[model samples]
Target: MKASIALQILPLSHSADRLQVIEKVIAYLQKQPVNQVVTPFETVLEGEWEELMLILKTAIELAGSEADNIFANVKINYGQILSIEEKIEKYHS
Candidate 1:
């Protein structure tokens, strides 16, 4: 089954520039095999839960490396497409 997740990442220190950090994140996501990952904006990632988690983890790691003062605020929500709602409901139940 495929699900969508949303993430919000922000850098933490005053000395850390937001634009530069965002740029690094954009570059990293662009290189991934998954073609639709978005950055500096809301993104809806479609993949298995485990695969999405790995992608998120990698994003955090890459962002962290860009600056010592960097930090990420991530929020993820999971839901299947309407066509698969029945399957999702069955899994949840």
Candidate 2:
């Protein structure tokens, strides 16, 4: 893979809307052409570097618009990266 991005978005919003906002972000990511693994805290995306960055930016923007503010953490491994399958394939059921 060209890169992998692990994104966690924390949106400051009403408790009622917080989960909805997060769902929107994940929905957007799911539409992209990438390998994805979603966890309780973050989502890991593996694909081309540019595509991943753009997807990350758009997901953050989508979250920010529905909340008071957005705090996001993005971890990127460029040039050389391990895909989600490569990291956890053996553990799959």
TM-score of each: 0.65, 0.90
Model 1 ranges off by over 4 Å? 35-40, 82-93
> Once superposed on the true structure, which residue ranges of model 2 sit more than 4 Å away at CA?
none
Residue 34, candidate 2: how far off, in angstroms?
Answer: 0.8
Task: Tell me the deviation in Å of residue 59 in model 2.
Answer: 0.7
- Candidate 1 per-residue lDDT, tens place, 20-68, comes to 8877776766676552546456444556767778888887887787667
lDDT of each: 0.65, 0.87
TM-score winner: 2
lDDT of 2 by residue, 1-93 (tens): 499989998876664387888899999999998999899999999999888888988998888888878789899889877778889978996
Q: Score residue 1 of candidate 2 by CA lDDT.
A: 40
- Clashing residue pairs in candidate 2 are none
